[model samples]
Target: MHEERPEVGVGPWEGELPSEGHYDPELLSNGDRRNVADKYRYWSMEAIVADLDERRHDFHIAIENWQHDMNIGTVVRTANAFLAKEVHIIGRRRWNKRGAMVTDRYQHVRHHPTVEDFVVWAKGEGLAIIGIDIFPDSEKLETYELPRNCVLVFGQEGPGLSEEVHQNAEATLSIEQFGSTRSINAASAAGIAMHAWIRRHVFDQSV
Candidate 1:
């Protein structure tokens, strides 16, 4: 049987009581509690991360950061939710952090000056790089054999994958499109790719 574990911090809160109260006014009255699982209720970010670190996923996530895209934060947040092994930023060292909602502190993120550097690092780690883009001659994502240990690389919002990224990827995949638009939002696409991986490897056994 699985042993019941304590929620939040390693130990219960211990300190002199404040004149105001136990809970912060801003967090309590404003209803600023997190949307995480019940186990993390009223927990600090540090506690949540410690729990997540004990059971992270195997796959890694990487995005082309040449444009300093605001979408990077959303991607990081989603990656954190899925507990991805790591997040790699290719190109620019800095990106818009507003979308990440302060979750970056809990996730492992790496910066690469260029796509070449990312590819080199991934190869060194025995991680196969898979590019998600709707380009000609690309394999259909639904049918591709995603590796258990791999990095899913996404391009910028508008232009899609860079030439260097395309050339470096072990395989390129395209999501089927039915709408008039050429592609979907970068963050949405990343979520879809991540879910597909989860379904293929993580969920198959249950079904």
Candidate 2:
């Protein structure tokens, strides 16, 4: 006898169908196996995004995709986890989305052809661009008080932050690493930086 595969999401609505506009009819009838929270089980994609927008965080996430970085997707996923206002992709318009695991569907993403274009947009939106990378002048992320309305920008995997982005950033920060590696992975570093921001702004912790 063959073993039955375990189902992912709910099988279907067991009772009367909801009349809310946000509910997805197909998902309700078939199932809702998407990787979303229980609160958004049967919600439409547009409806889920709309509801998230109501309480999105003040900070944004920007990444340089000069090399079509694979880490970009993971960074975007982290931004979604943190409820970032939006994600700005710089350098390359197209990126690898495998690491995002479909979180990008719920996250708002924008593309900028170059660093200059991204800087202009950030300034126009009153978002200070804070770079996350190691540099001569980079400060410790542990001590930094990230601005409430800033964008945490990251660089591509190998080269790290481009000179253009480094020069334009309001400040660059580095995470403390005690291991053998010179630096952590770009995606890992991004998550740490974003969590640092959350700790200060969301939890009111300075360190």
TM-score for each of the candidates = 0.81, 0.95
* Inter-residue clash pairs, candidate 2: none
| CA-lDDT, candidates in order | 0.83, 0.93
Worst 10 residues of 2 by lDDT: 198-207
Q: Which stretches of model 2 miss by more than 4 angstroms?
A: 1-5, 205-207
User: Residues 1-207, candidate 2, lDDT per residue (tens digit)?
Assistant: 999998777878999999999999999999899989899999999999999999999999999998889999899899999999999999889999999999999999999998999999999999989999999999999998899999999989899999999999999999998989999999999899989888998998553
Q: List RMSD in Å for every model shown.
A: 8.6, 1.9
- Estimate candidate 1's alpha-carbon lDDT, on a 0 to 1 scale: 0.83
Q: Highest TM-score, which number?
A: 2
The runs of at least 3 residues in candidate 1 whose Cα sits more than 4 Å from the true structure, single-residue gaps closed, are 1-32
- Model 1 vs truth, CA RMSD: 8.6
